[model samples]
Target: MNNRTGCEDPYLNYVISRRPFGWNFTDPPVFLPFDFEKVDPFYWVSLMETNWKVAFYAAAVYIFVIFGLQNYMKSRPPFELRKLLFIWNLSLGIFSVIGFVRYVPGFLFVLNQPNGFYKSICVKDGMDVPTGFWTLLFAFSKFWELGDTILIVLRKRRLVLIQYYHHVVTMIVVWIVGPLVEPIARWYTVLNFFVHSLMYPYFSLRAIGIRVPVFIANLITFLQLSQMIIGFTVNMTSLYHQQIGNDCVRYPISIQAFSLVYGSFIFLFGKLFYDSVIKSGRRRTEKKLL
Candidate 1:
């Protein structure tokens, strides 16, 4: 599994062993047709690490597009893109579910190894297989997810500061840090995939005029709020580990960005849940007493 040098199998670089189901098999799961390192586009992982201006420019464009669409739709009636919206959200929901299934197993497998979670994140290895490929796809998907703002703008829905804040900051941070497969990132990605797997499909059903219980909707918001709180805690722990030189590897910038971003989500989503669910529930209870 690992050598005395504190490294893992050179070819299966992140695993102690894929025993049980994969006991006889020698290789890790392969999702891509070719090795990710051999792929040309993956070179951007290192390139973007150095050329961060590209990420900034992409963020700028996303911001401009969202605001531009909102302004353009000011005088226009809200487009009834309900069918299209259902399709969009459904697609995202399906994608999130698939990501959950594919990545979570590999993620847990790595974690199950002896000190594997730390080693997987802290070290870079050529043989880490499909996890790298999925991470790239997940990062790339953020660019397209900017369309979520566009949809809101077209539908003439009120875009709060939280909405813009969540979208823009996520795009920037995810793009910049996506290549860094720090162990904390596994938690972030899995949380997102799990949340979206439920949230998006719920919204998609609503888009199609299918009414679900209000509690289901409330649960989604609650899950989001919980994720921010938990994620913040985990991130802080990671930073502490890094500070003590506990073999944790992460970009200083990534940790800093997450601090601000996750911190905002905690407050914003907390307020939203209180306003939309908790307060409203209290009002209904008071009215019933009358």
Candidate 2:
């Protein structure tokens, strides 16, 4: 082994991350933070093996909280909340970019081919790289995203079914799937970078009071669904191919959990898309006929 990295451990934040950011991913293993004492030792891992149970529990909790809050907000007049929501979403968006930008160059230049040789040759090339930073960033971003709920709550916005469910399930999913780790983490990050590159700007536009065209909204949803479809297929294939198990890296069980969530979300959200927009048009047409 090389004598030393001549630098501190890349995961110093794991043990000592402070707030506004957090100590979330500084964890027992992988790139996640160590000893997130709020949950049990295997809380993250249990989310994978018992996903449906956990997912439903999460969904139920959010539904109750969101709807309860919505009813409470009904008594109050609408407060001007755009600025706060905008800043919150924008901050998360920027954090996503920071995490994405930090990793892309290395993924492209070093791991372009993405077979066994890429890992080997990339390491030997003496790149000024941190081995596990992407995983760390991806892991860290989940904690940052908890702010999504804060905005909805503080701004007294109506927490719709989809938004509430998305927030809660994603919080649980990232905890379970460990989306930022080795093997699968690379592809997940790349795909997320691509997705968020589009997703965030859409938020930014709407935040600034620009109306996103209906077609644009539909296209964005389609792209998101497509991302999940591709991710599930590719990850399953990678899971199978890597069964040869020559240490080319692997996703751990958490990736599989995320794949299942992606599959479920695509199905649920696809239906949601049809129900919300297509049915709205159908209902309008039927009313016109009557």
Candidate 3:
């Protein structure tokens, strides 16, 4: 029960290996005993790895399109595409739910395996999970998610700097990590999918004129800020592990990049939560007292 790497199982074979510079990586057993190849093929994965530039170019175009469309819509009445919005948000919610269900367990199972949390986060692996197929899917999903911004523009909602910043930075991070098969960073993807599973559905219900509880809206923002805080902590731990020469396989430079991004996210999400929830709620209370 070994592959080319001579480990005991396919999981260990792909993840645990000797790297240059005297570093080593080891992984736990697969939660489900099946051949990774047996998993369904994702067609666009190869193209993503081979023609990485396409992601960059597409990201550039996304920025241009966001600005252009927003400007074009400025003079016109906002189209309340209620039905379309409902469908779009619901579909994305379902997609995020599926991603969360499929991938989070796989990663959590990895964490539960030997070597503890730090090793699980720091150890780099090859495309262990079917060309890193699900991970790649999550990365590509970011592109598909640009539709969220477009919808906002069409609706004449103000595009906050953090919104576009998150989209662009996320695409770049995923593009870099997806090809590298950086399993550690996929934690970000898992958390995002979980959040979106709830967030998108809430948006869909609102679009359809359903009354969602105000607390639900505040909870979503809190969860987003919490995600950033936890993520930043994990990256910091990874950085610390790498610094001590734990023999864990990691891309040092990439870890640095991720840490910086997570730091930024913490500030942005915190600010957003404060403005939209705390300050707004306080203002409402003041008005009620008056």
TM-score of each model, in listed order: 0.82, 0.63, 0.82
lDDT (tens digit, per residue) of candidate 1 on 116-226? 656445533222344555566677777777788789999999988887788778878887776665556767887888898999999899999999999999999999999
What is the TM-score of candidate 2?
0.63
lDDT of 1 at 233: 81
lDDT of each: 0.72, 0.55, 0.73
Scored against the true structure, residue 105 in model 2 reaches a CA lDDT of 55
Winner by TM-score between candidate 3 and candidate 1: 3
Candidates by TM-score, descending order: 3, 1, 2
- Give one digit per residue, the lDDT tens place, for model 3 in 235-281: 77776776787754557667777888888999999999999899999
lDDT of 3 at 106: 60
Question: What lDDT does model 2 reach?
Answer: 0.55
The CA lDDT at 136 in model 2 is 46
Position 177, candidate 3: lDDT: 59
Model 3: residues >4 Å from true position, as ranges? Answer: 1-46, 124-131, 288-290
